[model samples]
Target: MEDENDCISSDEEDQLDFLLGEEFGEDDDAELYSPPNVDTLSSQDTCSSQSSQSISDPLERHIYWKDDNTEDNGNVDLRTTPFKPTRQPGFQTTNFTRRQLQHLKTPLHFLNLFMTVEFLTTLCIATNHQANYLINTGKYSSYTDNGVWEAVTTDELLRFFGIIIYMSVVKLSALEKYWSTNVLYDHCPVNDVMTKKRFQAILCFIQVTSPGDIDKGQDCLEFK
Candidate 1:
């Protein structure tokens, strides 16, 4: 009986140990799987804090409630106004008088507006001076048969320009072909204005500025 009682007591001791072990294992599992204690605030308090931050931050509010046609700073909103297509006025010729417009009927009149009478007279004088200088220096003798160069007038200069324009329109193999006496090329309009010899003379000594004004180091553009 004493041994049986001792055995029962031992079994009870084993069951108590097993139950204590189970209790400790359950406690360890609960500790491992449990959430951390970092989020301590209540849901209402957390939501209120976020709302206050959003209200305090202007950029956050702007991003949340932005509108397309809103004014930036104090300036007017350009997007609020509708775009209108406008046709600008065309260019009007108000610079010139009616008399001037009527006078510019002919192409010659238009040409004279740029190359005035004074400019042509200046060109004639310069050309004549160059020619006389070359003739007096005996340089003209080499180029001409009679060694004689008639002073060019403004009228002759105009005729020379007209002949040049005509020649440009009527392209030839050589410049001399314009004055060619061949039956196929006779009665050329250039011959009516000036002789070939006179034209050549004018072309050879067509000066704009006097030789005295020319300097080796001076810019040619200044003369232009």
Candidate 2:
């Protein structure tokens, strides 16, 4: 009975050792089959190396089309293409002179206008003087017939000639032929000098903003 009990204990010991070895082998196999865990240090090193490889020169940013697709071998020279400036998308500068500007109107143009007004005024006054002279010298001075105009008298005839002379003088002077005797340039304000001064002042002000000399007188305006 002692020998049989000893044999039975040895078999139990052997069975227990085999079961432990199988469990340990399975644990080792599972550890080997599982995916590896990468270290943070190794990943950071690789990333730094890639960034260093990519870096070259700061001027490379301006160089576009510098690739294999371009004409040259993986590069392009800027000298070939060149750069031409384009007209921007807003108000551009013009080469117009000061005379072309609306603000800088020709002084002669204003002078002609003023001369026309003066001529009309002179004509009206001369006609009135001639008509009055004829009416006063007529037989029916009081005008027995209102519609009937009296025959032209010597005074009326003389006045007509005087008007012709006055108009001729006005035409010569107002044409800007003579600067000193210009009708528009009254020496004193009593002869509408203030109006002429204002007009000249406006011309000066316009010249200040635009780039030009204040072209005055007959030569300045260049009237035909």
Candidate 3:
């Protein structure tokens, strides 16, 4: 009886050990098969790496032609390809009004003549400064010398010629009327004395034409 009891106790101990072993196996399987949150971190890292790589390469941001298979590599014909500039668009073309165009033609003609004369004279004067100085001074002299002001006379002569030509060529209609008016006969605002004399004459005409006048000139003014 003592030996049989001891055998039964040993069997119970073996079954307990087998059950513990099975429980530990199940725990290890759960740990291995059930993944942790580290996979989320790895996915985020992969996306960040792709974004950084794209940022490092400028060509990745620019537009590129693709083939039917979505391949980016292609031949670029720079001559035939039109490129849009990265700038603001400007005004569209427009035509001038007829009246404005006609008025502009006269000013443009005068401006062209002025510019041509000014450009040519300036070029000649700049290139021949030394010659001009000698001719004006009547001798060889340094430009910075005491009496070198004589060289400036040559420039004055050139300016005088330009002014005379401009005045002779350019004219307005008002100048003719101004010359035709006689200050002695007409009352002039600029000629204050003549204006006063004309005013006195008008007063005399008024006095002579008064109601009680018995004069011939008074009668003539009355008729007037």
Candidate 4:
């Protein structure tokens, strides 16, 4: 009787093992990483088959490996090589002269600094300086107004506008290949935008100037 009961117990155990194999598959390898976060996985039955195969398959055992389970793990760094941009012909000198083209293609972020300075100078000349009548007449001695205050204002305005035009048209893009707004932060360490802009203008004067090609007067704008 005991021998018959032992046989029954063994049969029940084998049945349980067969049932587990059907449910989970043969290999029994637990995936370390979650599946890709995509909506298509909901309908996909690929993982179910995979799990079953992993649980039941004796030939395919789970091996401990890193995130990328490559057979040759040491050479993995070669996967991410940095890509350099190819230099295009005439990309640097289409608009500006050779002197103006030195650092022209360096980077857009640097070019933006000079562009901003030019814009600000133009704004000051076109908007703020236009209202001054006195400085204008003073600049032209023959057209001097009777009011001394008006003449003084006009003279200041003219000089101011002249400087602005020089900065905007000439010095901003001519002398340097790249411009940096970072200097503004260096001069005034405040977080205020207005103060930084003021420092940028001041630094522009310090850095930008006429090129040594004095013979090309038409090509260069004079700045004092």
Among the numbered candidates, top lDDT falls to: 1
The digit string of per-residue lDDT tens for model 3 on 1-224 reads 22542322333333334435544664433211111222222243454445334433332222233345764355554542458876657722245456644565564454554456555455344434544444365653333245442222333334433433543665435433222356543532223322323222222222212232335554454644
- Total backbone collisions for each predicted model: 0, 0, 0, 18
The true-structure Cα RMSD of candidate 2 reads 35.2
Per-residue lDDT, model 1, residue 47, is: 46
| Clashing residue pairs, backbone N/CA/C < 3 A, model 1 | none
* TM-score of every model versus the real structure: 0.54, 0.15, 0.18, 0.19
lDDT per residue as tens, model 2, 162-199:
43444465654342332344554554222222222322
Candidate 1, poorest ten consecutive residues by summed lDDT: 32-41
Kindly list the per-residue Cα lDDT of model 4 for residues 28-81, writing each as its tens digit.
443322223322223335543354345434312321224445565444232233
Off by over 4 Å in 2: 1-115, 139-224
Worst 10 residues of 3 by lDDT: 30-39
Q: Tell me model 1's lDDT, rounded to 2 decimals.
A: 0.65
The lowest-lDDT stretch of 10 consecutive residues in candidate 2 is 202-211
* Global lDDT of model 3: 0.38
* Candidate 1 structure quality by residue, lDDT tens digits, 1-224: 22542322333334334445544654433211111221221222444445434433432222223355755585533443335657447634577899878787788987787678898898998998888788878876654556666678999999888888888888999989888888888868777778888898888999997666657787777855
